[model samples]
Target: MGSFEFLLDGIVRAFELIVTLNPYILSITGVSIKVSGTATLLAAMTAIPLAFALSFVQFRGRHAVITLVNTGMGLPPVFVGLFVFVMLVPAGPLGFLNRIFTPEAMIIAQYILITPIITGITLSAIKAVPEPIIETVYTLGGREKDVVLTTLLEARFGVITAVLAGLGRALAEVGAILIVGGNIAYTGSVGGIGEGLSYTRTLTTAITSETSKGDISTSIALGIILIAIYLFVNVAAGFFRRQD
Candidate 1:
Protein backbone atom coordinates (compact mmCIF):
# COMPACT_ATOMS: atom_id res chain seq x y z
CA MET A 1 0.00 0.00 0.00
CA GLY A 2 2.76 2.39 0.89
CA SER A 3 4.64 1.63 -2.29
CA PHE A 4 1.51 2.09 -4.37
CA GLU A 5 0.84 5.44 -2.74
CA PHE A 6 4.39 6.53 -3.36
CA LEU A 7 4.10 5.62 -7.03
CA LEU A 8 0.80 7.44 -7.31
CA ASP A 9 2.31 10.51 -5.69
CA GLY A 10 5.24 10.38 -8.03
CA ILE A 11 2.96 10.12 -11.02
CA VAL A 12 0.96 13.12 -9.88
CA ARG A 13 4.10 15.17 -9.45
CA ALA A 14 5.27 14.04 -12.83
CA PHE A 15 2.15 15.43 -14.40
CA GLU A 16 2.72 18.67 -12.54
CA LEU A 17 6.21 18.93 -13.95
CA ILE A 18 4.88 18.35 -17.45
CA VAL A 19 1.93 20.67 -17.09
CA THR A 20 3.93 23.50 -15.60
CA LEU A 21 6.59 23.17 -18.30
CA ASN A 22 9.46 22.57 -15.99
CA PRO A 23 12.62 23.98 -17.50
CA TYR A 24 14.70 20.95 -16.78
CA ILE A 25 12.13 18.70 -18.39
CA LEU A 26 11.73 20.92 -21.43
CA SER A 27 15.46 21.30 -21.82
CA ILE A 28 15.96 17.59 -21.82
CA THR A 29 13.16 17.10 -24.32
CA GLY A 30 14.57 19.80 -26.54
CA VAL A 31 18.02 18.24 -26.64
CA SER A 32 16.42 14.92 -27.50
CA ILE A 33 14.48 16.46 -30.36
CA LYS A 34 17.38 18.51 -31.64
CA VAL A 35 20.00 15.81 -31.67
CA SER A 36 17.75 13.04 -32.92
CA GLY A 37 16.01 15.27 -35.37
CA THR A 38 19.23 16.55 -36.90
CA ALA A 39 20.85 13.15 -37.05
CA THR A 40 17.79 11.50 -38.53
CA LEU A 41 17.39 14.25 -41.07
CA LEU A 42 20.99 13.90 -42.14
CA ALA A 43 20.71 10.14 -42.20
CA ALA A 44 17.60 10.29 -44.36
CA MET A 45 19.27 12.62 -46.78
CA THR A 46 22.19 10.26 -47.29
CA ALA A 47 20.51 6.90 -46.74
CA ILE A 48 17.62 7.42 -49.13
CA PRO A 49 19.98 8.34 -51.92
CA LEU A 50 22.30 5.48 -51.07
CA ALA A 51 19.42 3.04 -50.98
CA PHE A 52 18.22 4.26 -54.35
CA ALA A 53 21.69 3.76 -55.79
CA LEU A 54 22.01 0.31 -54.30
CA SER A 55 18.69 -0.68 -55.74
CA PHE A 56 19.20 0.89 -59.16
CA VAL A 57 22.85 0.35 -59.94
CA GLN A 58 24.73 -2.86 -60.76
CA PHE A 59 28.32 -2.51 -59.76
CA ARG A 60 31.19 -4.72 -58.70
CA GLY A 61 30.99 -5.65 -55.00
CA ARG A 62 27.39 -4.38 -54.86
CA HIS A 63 26.34 -7.52 -53.03
CA ALA A 64 29.16 -7.05 -50.60
CA VAL A 65 28.09 -3.46 -50.05
CA ILE A 66 24.52 -4.49 -49.31
CA THR A 67 25.77 -7.15 -46.95
CA LEU A 68 27.87 -4.59 -45.15
CA VAL A 69 24.90 -2.27 -44.78
CA ASN A 70 22.75 -5.10 -43.47
CA THR A 71 25.43 -5.96 -40.97
CA GLY A 72 25.71 -2.32 -39.88
CA MET A 73 21.98 -2.13 -39.15
CA GLY A 74 22.57 -4.47 -36.20
CA LEU A 75 25.65 -2.73 -34.85
CA PRO A 76 25.47 -2.33 -31.07
CA PRO A 77 24.96 1.26 -29.97
CA VAL A 78 27.46 0.97 -27.11
CA PHE A 79 30.07 -0.36 -29.45
CA VAL A 80 29.44 2.45 -31.90
CA GLY A 81 29.70 4.92 -29.05
CA LEU A 82 33.01 3.50 -27.99
CA PHE A 83 34.27 3.66 -31.55
CA VAL A 84 33.22 7.30 -31.87
CA PHE A 85 34.74 8.09 -28.48
CA VAL A 86 38.03 6.61 -29.49
CA MET A 87 38.09 8.56 -32.72
CA LEU A 88 37.14 11.82 -31.04
CA VAL A 89 39.74 11.61 -28.28
CA PRO A 90 42.57 14.14 -28.67
CA ALA A 91 45.18 11.59 -29.59
CA GLY A 92 43.04 9.96 -32.26
CA PRO A 93 43.53 10.80 -35.94
CA LEU A 94 40.21 12.64 -36.29
CA GLY A 95 40.50 14.24 -32.87
CA PHE A 96 41.82 17.53 -34.24
CA LEU A 97 38.23 18.61 -34.87
CA ASN A 98 37.55 18.20 -31.14
CA ARG A 99 34.01 16.83 -31.43
CA ILE A 100 34.04 14.55 -28.40
CA PHE A 101 31.51 14.91 -25.55
CA THR A 102 29.44 17.38 -27.55
CA PRO A 103 26.08 17.36 -29.28
CA GLU A 104 27.90 17.16 -32.60
CA ALA A 105 29.56 13.98 -31.41
CA MET A 106 26.21 12.63 -30.31
CA ILE A 107 24.79 13.47 -33.71
CA ILE A 108 27.67 11.67 -35.38
CA ALA A 109 27.17 8.63 -33.18
CA GLN A 110 23.44 8.49 -33.87
CA TYR A 111 24.01 9.12 -37.56
CA ILE A 112 26.37 6.16 -37.68
CA LEU A 113 23.91 4.01 -35.77
CA ILE A 114 20.80 4.82 -37.83
CA THR A 115 22.18 5.45 -41.32
CA PRO A 116 22.52 1.75 -42.07
CA ILE A 117 19.09 1.02 -40.62
CA ILE A 118 17.50 3.61 -42.86
CA THR A 119 19.52 2.49 -45.83
CA GLY A 120 18.74 -1.20 -45.41
CA ILE A 121 15.02 -0.70 -44.89
CA THR A 122 14.78 1.72 -47.74
CA LEU A 123 16.75 -0.62 -49.94
CA SER A 124 14.38 -3.46 -49.18
CA ALA A 125 11.47 -1.19 -49.99
CA ILE A 126 13.05 -0.21 -53.27
CA LYS A 127 13.75 -3.85 -54.09
CA ALA A 128 10.15 -4.72 -53.34
CA VAL A 129 9.08 -2.25 -55.97
CA PRO A 130 7.64 -4.13 -58.96
CA GLU A 131 10.01 -4.86 -61.82
CA PRO A 132 7.43 -3.62 -64.29
CA ILE A 133 7.79 -0.13 -62.89
CA ILE A 134 11.38 0.00 -64.07
CA GLU A 135 10.59 -1.80 -67.31
CA THR A 136 7.71 0.56 -67.97
CA VAL A 137 10.01 3.54 -67.47
CA TYR A 138 12.51 2.13 -69.94
CA THR A 139 9.79 1.15 -72.38
CA LEU A 140 8.66 4.76 -72.38
CA GLY A 141 12.26 5.81 -73.31
CA GLY A 142 12.79 7.20 -69.79
CA ARG A 143 16.40 7.64 -68.79
CA GLU A 144 18.16 6.13 -65.78
CA LYS A 145 17.39 9.23 -63.73
CA ASP A 146 13.72 8.88 -64.58
CA VAL A 147 13.71 5.26 -63.43
CA VAL A 148 15.34 6.24 -60.17
CA LEU A 149 12.76 8.92 -59.55
CA THR A 150 9.92 6.61 -60.50
CA THR A 151 11.13 3.92 -58.15
CA LEU A 152 11.53 6.49 -55.41
CA LEU A 153 7.98 7.64 -55.99
CA GLU A 154 6.75 4.08 -55.78
CA ALA A 155 8.77 3.48 -52.62
CA ARG A 156 7.95 6.82 -50.98
CA PHE A 157 5.94 5.31 -48.18
CA GLY A 158 8.67 2.83 -47.37
CA VAL A 159 11.27 5.56 -47.41
CA ILE A 160 9.19 7.61 -45.01
CA THR A 161 8.80 4.59 -42.77
CA ALA A 162 12.53 4.05 -42.86
CA VAL A 163 13.17 7.64 -41.83
CA LEU A 164 10.66 7.40 -39.02
CA ALA A 165 12.09 4.13 -37.84
CA GLY A 166 15.51 5.72 -37.77
CA LEU A 167 14.13 8.69 -35.89
CA GLY A 168 12.41 6.43 -33.39
CA ARG A 169 15.61 4.54 -32.88
CA ALA A 170 17.57 7.74 -32.49
CA LEU A 171 15.14 9.26 -30.00
CA ALA A 172 15.08 6.17 -27.84
CA GLU A 173 18.85 5.76 -27.94
CA VAL A 174 20.79 6.39 -24.72
CA GLY A 175 23.94 4.35 -24.79
CA ALA A 176 25.57 6.04 -27.77
CA ILE A 177 24.49 9.55 -26.93
CA LEU A 178 25.22 9.09 -23.25
CA ILE A 179 28.74 8.11 -24.05
CA VAL A 180 29.23 10.76 -26.70
CA GLY A 181 27.26 13.63 -25.20
CA GLY A 182 28.31 12.94 -21.62
CA ASN A 183 24.74 13.91 -20.68
CA ILE A 184 25.88 17.33 -19.61
CA ALA A 185 23.56 19.85 -18.01
CA TYR A 186 24.09 23.47 -17.13
CA THR A 187 25.55 24.14 -13.72
CA GLY A 188 23.29 27.00 -12.60
CA SER A 189 19.53 27.39 -12.56
CA VAL A 190 18.28 28.83 -15.85
CA GLY A 191 14.51 28.58 -15.49
CA GLY A 192 14.00 28.42 -11.74
CA ILE A 193 13.29 24.68 -11.96
CA GLY A 194 15.73 23.87 -9.12
CA GLU A 195 17.67 21.49 -11.28
CA GLY A 196 19.92 22.99 -13.88
CA LEU A 197 18.55 22.91 -17.40
CA SER A 198 19.94 20.36 -19.78
CA TYR A 199 22.66 21.24 -22.24
CA THR A 200 23.43 17.92 -23.83
CA ARG A 201 21.11 15.83 -21.67
CA THR A 202 18.17 14.17 -23.39
CA LEU A 203 14.96 12.56 -22.20
CA THR A 204 16.34 9.01 -22.25
CA THR A 205 19.56 9.90 -20.51
CA ALA A 206 17.79 12.21 -18.12
CA ILE A 207 15.36 9.51 -17.07
CA THR A 208 18.30 7.26 -16.26
CA SER A 209 20.03 10.08 -14.38
CA GLU A 210 17.00 11.17 -12.39
CA THR A 211 16.00 7.63 -11.49
CA SER A 212 19.49 7.00 -10.23
CA LYS A 213 19.27 10.10 -8.06
CA GLY A 214 15.94 8.85 -6.62
CA ASP A 215 14.10 11.68 -8.32
CA ILE A 216 11.12 9.59 -9.22
CA SER A 217 8.90 12.48 -10.28
CA THR A 218 11.41 13.77 -12.78
CA SER A 219 11.95 10.30 -14.16
CA ILE A 220 8.25 9.73 -14.52
CA ALA A 221 7.81 13.08 -16.20
CA LEU A 222 10.48 12.27 -18.76
CA GLY A 223 9.02 8.83 -19.28
CA ILE A 224 5.55 10.20 -19.93
CA ILE A 225 6.91 12.64 -22.47
CA LEU A 226 9.04 10.00 -24.13
CA ILE A 227 6.06 7.66 -24.48
CA ALA A 228 3.97 10.47 -25.86
CA ILE A 229 6.63 11.38 -28.41
CA TYR A 230 6.98 7.77 -29.52
CA LEU A 231 3.23 7.49 -29.92
CA PHE A 232 3.24 10.56 -32.07
CA VAL A 233 5.93 9.08 -34.30
CA ASN A 234 3.97 5.82 -34.59
CA VAL A 235 0.78 7.66 -35.41
CA ALA A 236 2.57 9.63 -38.07
CA ALA A 237 3.99 6.45 -39.54
CA GLY A 238 0.57 4.82 -39.56
CA PHE A 239 -0.97 7.81 -41.24
CA PHE A 240 1.60 7.73 -44.04
CA ARG A 241 1.19 3.98 -44.40
CA ARG A 242 -2.54 4.37 -44.82
CA GLN A 243 -1.96 6.88 -47.59
CA ASP A 244 -0.71 4.01 -49.73
Candidate 2:
Protein backbone atom coordinates (compact mmCIF):
# COMPACT_ATOMS: atom_id res chain seq x y z
CA MET A 1 0.00 0.00 0.00
CA GLY A 2 1.06 3.61 -0.57
CA SER A 3 2.06 5.57 2.51
CA PHE A 4 -1.15 7.63 2.52
CA GLU A 5 -3.33 4.57 2.10
CA PHE A 6 -1.37 2.68 4.72
CA LEU A 7 -1.91 5.43 7.27
CA LEU A 8 -5.59 5.74 6.34
CA ASP A 9 -6.08 2.00 6.71
CA GLY A 10 -4.56 2.03 10.17
CA ILE A 11 -6.82 4.87 11.25
CA VAL A 12 -9.90 3.10 9.92
CA ARG A 13 -9.08 -0.04 11.82
CA ALA A 14 -8.37 2.06 14.92
CA PHE A 15 -11.86 3.54 14.82
CA GLU A 16 -13.24 0.06 14.37
CA LEU A 17 -11.59 -1.09 17.55
CA ILE A 18 -12.94 1.90 19.40
CA VAL A 19 -16.45 1.57 17.97
CA THR A 20 -16.57 -2.09 18.85
CA LEU A 21 -15.23 -1.39 22.34
CA ASN A 22 -12.57 -4.01 21.92
CA PRO A 23 -12.13 -5.78 25.23
CA TYR A 24 -8.41 -5.12 25.50
CA ILE A 25 -8.84 -1.46 24.63
CA LEU A 26 -11.64 -1.05 27.12
CA SER A 27 -9.65 -2.79 29.82
CA ILE A 28 -6.62 -0.51 29.52
CA THR A 29 -8.80 2.60 29.30
CA GLY A 30 -10.60 1.56 32.46
CA VAL A 31 -7.34 0.90 34.24
CA SER A 32 -5.92 4.26 33.19
CA ILE A 33 -8.92 6.13 34.55
CA LYS A 34 -8.96 4.11 37.74
CA VAL A 35 -5.28 4.58 38.60
CA SER A 36 -5.01 8.24 37.58
CA GLY A 37 -8.34 9.11 39.13
CA THR A 38 -7.49 7.50 42.44
CA ALA A 39 -4.07 9.12 42.58
CA THR A 40 -5.49 12.57 41.82
CA LEU A 41 -8.16 12.19 44.48
CA LEU A 42 -5.71 11.11 47.12
CA ALA A 43 -3.25 13.82 46.17
CA ALA A 44 -5.93 16.50 46.31
CA MET A 45 -7.06 15.36 49.73
CA THR A 46 -3.53 15.42 51.09
CA ALA A 47 -2.29 18.50 49.27
CA ILE A 48 -5.28 20.73 49.92
CA PRO A 49 -5.07 20.25 53.65
CA LEU A 50 -1.33 20.71 53.70
CA ALA A 51 -1.65 23.78 51.51
CA PHE A 52 -4.10 25.31 53.92
CA ALA A 53 -1.75 24.68 56.76
CA LEU A 54 1.11 26.31 54.94
CA SER A 55 -1.02 29.30 54.06
CA PHE A 56 -2.63 29.90 57.43
CA VAL A 57 -0.39 28.50 60.08
CA GLN A 58 2.64 30.39 61.33
CA PHE A 59 5.47 28.00 61.99
CA ARG A 60 9.23 27.69 61.78
CA GLY A 61 11.00 26.23 58.74
CA ARG A 62 8.02 27.24 56.60
CA HIS A 63 10.40 28.49 53.93
CA ALA A 64 12.09 25.12 53.88
CA VAL A 65 8.74 23.41 53.45
CA ILE A 66 7.87 25.72 50.57
CA THR A 67 11.25 25.07 49.00
CA LEU A 68 10.64 21.35 49.17
CA VAL A 69 7.27 21.71 47.46
CA ASN A 70 8.79 23.77 44.68
CA THR A 71 11.55 21.22 44.26
CA GLY A 72 9.17 18.30 44.14
CA MET A 73 7.00 20.02 41.54
CA GLY A 74 9.88 19.72 39.09
CA LEU A 75 10.98 16.19 40.02
CA PRO A 76 11.63 13.83 37.10
CA PRO A 77 9.01 11.14 36.65
CA VAL A 78 11.51 8.43 35.90
CA PHE A 79 13.39 9.30 39.06
CA VAL A 80 10.21 9.00 41.05
CA GLY A 81 9.60 5.62 39.49
CA LEU A 82 13.07 4.43 40.36
CA PHE A 83 12.65 5.59 43.93
CA VAL A 84 9.39 3.73 44.35
CA PHE A 85 10.69 0.65 42.62
CA VAL A 86 13.66 0.47 44.92
CA MET A 87 11.50 0.63 47.99
CA LEU A 88 9.13 -2.03 46.68
CA VAL A 89 11.52 -4.53 45.16
CA PRO A 90 12.32 -7.70 47.08
CA ALA A 91 15.10 -7.22 49.65
CA GLY A 92 14.40 -3.49 49.64
CA PRO A 93 13.00 -1.63 52.57
CA LEU A 94 9.16 -1.75 52.71
CA GLY A 95 9.33 -4.67 50.26
CA PHE A 96 7.34 -6.85 52.62
CA LEU A 97 4.16 -5.27 51.20
CA ASN A 98 5.06 -6.88 47.87
CA ARG A 99 3.44 -4.16 45.79
CA ILE A 100 5.91 -4.15 42.91
CA PHE A 101 4.40 -4.20 39.41
CA THR A 102 0.93 -3.67 40.83
CA PRO A 103 -1.71 -0.98 40.39
CA GLU A 104 -1.12 0.02 43.99
CA ALA A 105 2.51 0.66 43.22
CA MET A 106 1.58 2.80 40.25
CA ILE A 107 -0.77 4.78 42.45
CA ILE A 108 1.93 5.32 45.03
CA ALA A 109 4.41 6.57 42.43
CA GLN A 110 1.88 8.95 40.88
CA TYR A 111 0.88 10.18 44.29
CA ILE A 112 4.42 11.18 45.10
CA LEU A 113 4.92 12.82 41.73
CA ILE A 114 1.74 14.95 41.81
CA THR A 115 1.42 15.72 45.51
CA PRO A 116 3.87 18.60 45.26
CA ILE A 117 2.25 19.90 42.08
CA ILE A 118 -1.14 20.09 43.75
CA THR A 119 0.32 21.49 46.92
CA GLY A 120 2.25 24.23 45.17
CA ILE A 121 -0.74 25.31 43.09
CA THR A 122 -3.07 25.18 46.07
CA LEU A 123 -0.68 27.19 48.16
CA SER A 124 -0.56 29.86 45.49
CA ALA A 125 -4.34 29.88 45.23
CA ILE A 126 -4.77 30.23 48.95
CA LYS A 127 -2.16 32.96 49.02
CA ALA A 128 -4.01 34.84 46.30
CA VAL A 129 -6.94 35.42 48.63
CA PRO A 130 -7.46 39.12 49.36
CA GLU A 131 -6.05 40.26 52.67
CA PRO A 132 -9.11 42.34 53.47
CA ILE A 133 -11.46 39.39 53.33
CA ILE A 134 -9.40 37.54 55.90
CA GLU A 135 -9.22 40.66 58.01
CA THR A 136 -13.00 41.05 57.71
CA VAL A 137 -13.46 37.54 59.02
CA TYR A 138 -11.22 38.25 61.96
CA THR A 139 -12.95 41.60 62.58
CA LEU A 140 -16.25 39.79 62.76
CA GLY A 141 -14.93 37.68 65.64
CA GLY A 142 -14.44 34.67 63.38
CA ARG A 143 -12.09 32.08 64.83
CA GLU A 144 -9.05 30.67 63.03
CA LYS A 145 -11.17 27.80 61.77
CA ASP A 146 -13.66 30.24 60.26
CA VAL A 147 -10.85 32.16 58.61
CA VAL A 148 -9.50 29.01 57.06
CA LEU A 149 -12.91 27.97 55.79
CA THR A 150 -13.57 31.38 54.30
CA THR A 151 -10.24 31.40 52.52
CA LEU A 152 -10.89 27.93 51.15
CA LEU A 153 -14.25 29.03 49.77
CA GLU A 154 -12.69 32.04 48.11
CA ALA A 155 -10.06 29.85 46.45
CA ARG A 156 -12.32 26.94 45.59
CA PHE A 157 -12.06 27.52 41.85
CA GLY A 158 -8.27 27.56 41.93
CA VAL A 159 -8.25 24.38 43.97
CA ILE A 160 -10.45 22.76 41.35
CA THR A 161 -8.00 23.86 38.69
CA ALA A 162 -5.15 22.45 40.71
CA VAL A 163 -6.85 19.08 41.05
CA LEU A 164 -7.55 19.00 37.33
CA ALA A 165 -3.92 19.80 36.57
CA GLY A 166 -2.84 16.90 38.73
CA LEU A 167 -5.29 14.61 36.96
CA GLY A 168 -3.95 15.66 33.58
CA ARG A 169 -0.41 15.00 34.74
CA ALA A 170 -1.34 11.57 36.05
CA LEU A 171 -3.16 10.66 32.85
CA ALA A 172 -0.31 11.70 30.59
CA GLU A 173 2.33 10.06 32.76
CA VAL A 174 4.02 6.94 31.37
CA GLY A 175 7.55 6.70 32.67
CA ALA A 176 6.80 6.28 36.35
CA ILE A 177 3.85 3.98 35.92
CA LEU A 178 5.68 1.97 33.25
CA ILE A 179 8.41 1.20 35.72
CA VAL A 180 6.35 0.72 38.88
CA GLY A 181 3.41 -0.89 37.11
CA GLY A 182 5.43 -2.99 34.65
CA ASN A 183 2.80 -2.10 32.02
CA ILE A 184 1.44 -5.57 32.57
CA ALA A 185 -1.39 -7.11 30.54
CA TYR A 186 -2.72 -10.65 30.73
CA THR A 187 -0.67 -13.26 28.92
CA GLY A 188 -3.40 -14.99 26.92
CA SER A 189 -4.94 -13.99 23.60
CA VAL A 190 -8.20 -12.10 23.04
CA GLY A 191 -10.22 -12.30 19.83
CA GLY A 192 -7.19 -14.17 18.44
CA ILE A 193 -5.02 -11.10 19.07
CA GLY A 194 -1.90 -11.70 21.06
CA GLU A 195 -2.79 -9.15 23.75
CA GLY A 196 -5.10 -9.98 26.65
CA LEU A 197 -7.11 -8.05 29.20
CA SER A 198 -5.43 -5.34 31.25
CA TYR A 199 -3.89 -6.40 34.49
CA THR A 200 -1.80 -3.31 35.26
CA ARG A 201 -1.79 -1.85 31.76
CA THR A 202 -2.90 1.73 31.13
CA LEU A 203 -3.56 3.74 27.97
CA THR A 204 -0.36 5.79 28.03
CA THR A 205 1.85 2.82 28.85
CA ALA A 206 0.04 0.62 26.37
CA ILE A 207 0.50 3.17 23.60
CA THR A 208 4.26 3.17 24.13
CA SER A 209 4.36 -0.60 24.18
CA GLU A 210 2.17 -0.93 21.08
CA THR A 211 4.09 1.63 19.05
CA SER A 212 7.43 0.15 20.02
CA LYS A 213 6.21 -3.24 18.73
CA GLY A 214 5.14 -1.59 15.40
CA ASP A 215 1.46 -2.25 16.03
CA ILE A 216 0.33 0.98 14.45
CA SER A 217 -3.36 0.16 14.47
CA THR A 218 -3.47 -0.59 18.15
CA SER A 219 -1.35 2.46 18.91
CA ILE A 220 -3.71 4.65 16.92
CA ALA A 221 -6.70 3.21 18.73
CA LEU A 222 -5.16 3.94 22.10
CA GLY A 223 -4.02 7.37 20.97
CA ILE A 224 -7.60 8.25 20.04
CA ILE A 225 -8.83 7.31 23.50
CA LEU A 226 -6.01 9.22 25.18
CA ILE A 227 -6.70 12.37 23.18
CA ALA A 228 -10.37 12.14 24.06
CA ILE A 229 -9.48 11.98 27.74
CA TYR A 230 -7.18 14.99 27.44
CA LEU A 231 -9.84 16.98 25.62
CA PHE A 232 -12.36 16.24 28.33
CA VAL A 233 -10.02 17.31 31.09
CA ASN A 234 -9.03 20.50 29.26
CA VAL A 235 -12.66 21.36 28.66
CA ALA A 236 -13.42 20.87 32.32
CA ALA A 237 -10.44 22.98 33.29
CA GLY A 238 -11.54 25.76 30.97
CA PHE A 239 -15.04 25.72 32.41
CA PHE A 240 -13.77 26.01 35.96
CA ARG A 241 -11.38 28.83 35.04
CA ARG A 242 -14.21 30.74 33.43
CA GLN A 243 -16.22 30.33 36.62
CA ASP A 244 -13.30 31.73 38.57
Q: What TM-score, computed on C-alpha atoms, does each candidate reach?
A: 0.94, 0.94
Instruction: Give the residue spans of candidate 1 off by over 4 A.
Output: 190-193, 240-244
lDDT top scorer: 2
Cα error of candidate 2 at position 63, Å? 0.9
Clash list (residue pairs), candidate 2:
none
Q: Where does model 2 exceed 4 Å of error?
A: 237-244
- How well is each residue in 1-244 modelled by candidate 1, as lDDT tens digits? 5999989988999999989888889989999999999999999999999998888788999999999999999999999999999999889878999988889999999999999999999998998999998999999999999999999999888888899889989999999999989999988865665679787899999989889999998899899999999899889778867876
Over the stretch 1-32, how does candidate 2's per-residue lDDT look in tens digits? 89898789889989999998899999999999
